[model samples]
Target: MTARDNRLHAFRPDLADARLEGEVSAERFVAGRPARVAAPVADVRRAPRPDAGLNTQLLCGDDVLVFDEAEGFAWLQAERDGYVGYVSAADLAPRAADPTHVVTAPRSFVYPGPDMKLPRVRALSLGSRVTVTGEAETRGTRYGLLPSGEAMVLQHLAPIGTVAEDFVSVAERLIDTPYLWGGSSAFGIDCSGLVQLSMHMAGRDVLRDSDMQAGALGTPLDPGPDHSALRRGDLVFWKGHVAIMTDAANMIHANGHTMTVAREGLREAIARIGYLYGGPTGFRRP
Candidate 1:
């Protein structure tokens, strides 16, 4: 698909957000006020929507520092595990975050209904690759971030491929994964996740994050027939994302707004996500 800028913002709050379930411990949270505590514990959860400090997700356990109380969010550092995001006050646990966690296979569960239970989160198929960044406890179950940037239960999975072929083969499985923010699974994925998983399936260790990925591949070529002759298995990369080219003018990838794996007009998808959509890092193949 030709690269194009999608104006819509795909930054949906994590399922751990208060919309689904009451903010439980371990659900990332922020505070509207900075209430001084005698001493913070590693497992201390914050009160719902603390009206004082901003607890942004940081690389630490439940330990959070009060940044801006007016921001209605607190900048928090995870003491148990360091990964950060904004959490609303209503759900902030004034105590230690919970350890109930779940992870996704390779591709699974694009969207979980508001009423969906947690244990059933694993009903989807196991993905070949997994990354546990975010966590949430719904009802009595734990859900973690799927590679697709969604939420799912932990699971076991098999390999996708052995080398570059694996990237091409396994990616073929997500021909329709929807585009999602922070998504990295087949159920819903973003541009970067598609590239990362494709490479992972091939048994080729590549950087998982998007910006870092720009430097992970070998020297890139221009997106044209003259540039080493584009192949079906060649890689098409942009500033913050990548895709697999199935033809000289066609490619497959997950877009945030599109929210699905799709074959886009090669130059167009590239132009949209690359030149127009905060990308243009270029393409590469191994």
Candidate 2:
């Protein structure tokens, strides 16, 4: 059967076209268990090993469809982007509790107790979700209790439904964050990850990759030679890269060339990217 005909095609498209001799069926391998990320940050790996290549990351409260569990890994598909990979079984919880708050700062510490002097439980990246089960005040500082019973500064989090006025501003907050391929957290992010995370904070559902984003987001912009028509929030697309126009003259993106999120003159960026990847393929405005 063709790739599209297989029931598990989306989970493992590579095996769809392989010839099988016996009466083997894809359903024999499907587990179909629902799961959610329990850790502050869980790395999704290409293989079921601790040292395997990282494919992506899942933050707390992110949902996944667990297809199998073996050794210390759980093979699953991320709910947000449908990415198939293996996450540590320790990070996958059967409970799918709804999140009440999202981390608003670039990063925030989860304290063992409500006091600032207490040991930190973990650090959560921006956009990480958590369930607040209670509230407390210590030494004049207010904190929220996570479902795991850890305390985090309430001011560092916003209700899950909160949205930023400008997504570009959200992207700018991560100026010095290191670039990681397929990373979506503040610790490290890719070009499309920055776009997706920023747009998500601004209440827009953006695709995970640049190519998918180029086809899914915004209105097509017709720019004359030299791209003199770009404006704030405009999305410029390259063959496999993307950036946000901060204004008429500047653009921001997480580029491996820079090794971090940075702003550059639109003309300078155009010239630099043109030399590297043949200029932008298109422009779009959301």
> Each prediction's TM-score against the native?
0.46, 0.88
The C-alpha lDDT values of all candidates are: 0.46, 0.82
The TM-score of predicted model 1 comes to 0.46
lDDT of 2 by residue, 1-286 (tens): 2333222233452221122312344434444577889887889888889989876788878888886778989877777766667899999788656889999999999998788898887899998888898999998999999776789999999998999999999999999999998788999999998998899889887667787778768889986676778889999999899999998778999998889999988788878889779978889998
* Residue 25 in candidate 1, Cα distance off native in Å: 30
Per-candidate Cα RMSD to the true structure, in Å, reads: 13.5, 4.1
**Clash pairs for candidate 2:** none
Best TM-score among the predictions, by candidate number? 2
RMSD of model 1 against the true structure: 13.5
Regions more than 4 Å wrong, model 2 = 1-9, 13-31
